[model samples]
Target: MKILCGSAGWTDKTLIACKRFYPADCRTAEARLRFYASQFPLVEVDSSYYGMPSAANSALWVDRTPADFTFDIKAFRLLTGHQTVRESLPKDIAMAIPETGKKNLYYRDVPAEVLDELWRSYREALEPLRNAGKLGAVLFQFAPWLMCGPKGNAHVEECADRMQEYTVAVEFRNESWLNDRHAFDTLELLRRRKLVHVIIDAPETVTNRAHTLWQVTNPELAFVRLHGRDAEKWNATGAPTAAGRFDYDYSDNELAQISGPIRDVSRRTAKTHVIFNNCREDQGQRNARTLMKILGR
Candidate 1:
């Protein structure tokens, strides 16, 4: 698996605010990125949460990295949140909730127009990344409530279509996808389309755990995220505390636990990607380095 680390060059506030991976001190983004690339070949940028970046920003990122280094960009929040459904919901569902509320379908049941607008916005935001050759897959990560169903498959298809402008990779939070034929069908469709499948790894015993790991069943590129195993507070409002708090480093033995599956997939796939989403202050940074050491990259 190609090891990729999370954000670096965080401030002290970011450290205390995040607490998981923050150091007492760190350097600038460019300096830290250069240092990191010297160890790992790729990075997964999670900072593009608000929207697409300006062209200048993407250029700056490219210039900072060596020609051989690469970056994986996460999709916009609007895409991740299923913002298209915010239209058309009844007034109760629409204005009934607060913007900051963690409601599943904030303003769902709205018209398809909202979805269309969202899809358009999604494309616009990804353009800069694509133009810079820094764009990876449009990580279509769904919330746990987004269970697998006919509707989801349609949306998945549409996601791939919308991604014609770039690479599209999907990650499922709902486990109903595990046994259902729909899951296999969806996987087959993704394989046929040559879109990447993002395998996820998280503490499965927790309430609403996202995924066990990025299942590298196919030979396409693999994208995996290791969200720490904070099984207790997973469902509470304070989840991000644990989510971005605990350290879940893979010991040398545990790294062996994953090597075979990765190699098995690599036997067929062109390239594989493993992302450490351990958002705890510096755990992601630390774990990423450990993974690179283990992988001898």
Candidate 2:
């Protein structure tokens, strides 16, 4: 089994501001990516979730990283039924939308043609990475309101159909998806669609948060995201940034405890990707390195 450990994204503001992970000379974007690639074999593209990615940028990413390095891109907010800013859409697409009074865009608000265009553009943007064998998976992280019901299931199926050509991974934020009543059916649904189940390590104190389940829905790959155990901030209202929401570091003991389950999941799948999402001041990078060492990778 192959195990790849990495952070959610390489370019977090706090991660850079800390001045601990990167060398002093590595200041530019190119230099930072090259330096990060030298340390970790994989990375998750978190920025892509906020807005559409350009093909040119993806091509540049292909050039900067090592041949074996892989990138798991987070699905765009619009694609995953989240409330997206109107400006986040491509300028052309934004202009095309019939001037609704609303400032935000949701999946239900778009016309079929516009939806098709958005999906096409998103897939095209990642072509460079896919062609180069560096695209790991397109992660579809559903919103907390997306419950375990017919509507949510249909949406998941739609997303899977849209990205049928690529490796798809599903991360459910709502607890209902894996609750005592729906856990079996949810896993079965993912298994039927061949969607890689994304195991989350988050603050379990929140009632809405999904429980951490170690099962693998797709035998091809398994994904794990550690969001730290900061229960207080997990559901804190009016947080300034995601870093503030996911702000906790893993101790050596914590990493060692999770390493065993990660290894077990890796054994079941052909490959496993473990990503740290704690973006406070190089915590993810430091924790990822520690986990890698513990796993003897």
Considering every candidate listed, which one attains the maximal lDDT?
2
Error (Å) of candidate 1 at residue 154 is: 1.6
For each of the candidates, the C-alpha root-mean-square deviation to the true structure, in angstroms, is 5.5, 0.9
The positional error of residue 291 in candidate 2, measured at the CA in angstroms, is 0.6
lDDT for 264 (candidate 1): 59
After TM-score superposition, the amount by which residue 32's alpha carbon in candidate 1 deviates from its true location, in angstroms, is 3.2
Q: Residue 192 deviation, candidate 1, in Å? A: 3.2
Looking at model 2, residue 151 earns an lDDT score of 99
Per-residue alpha-carbon lDDT of model 1 for 105-171, expressed as tens digits? 4224434666566556556655655666766656767655676777666666766787775666777
What TM-score does each of the candidates earn? 0.75, 0.98
In terms of lDDT, the poorest run of 10 residues in model 2 is 236-245
Inter-residue clash pairs, candidate 2 = none
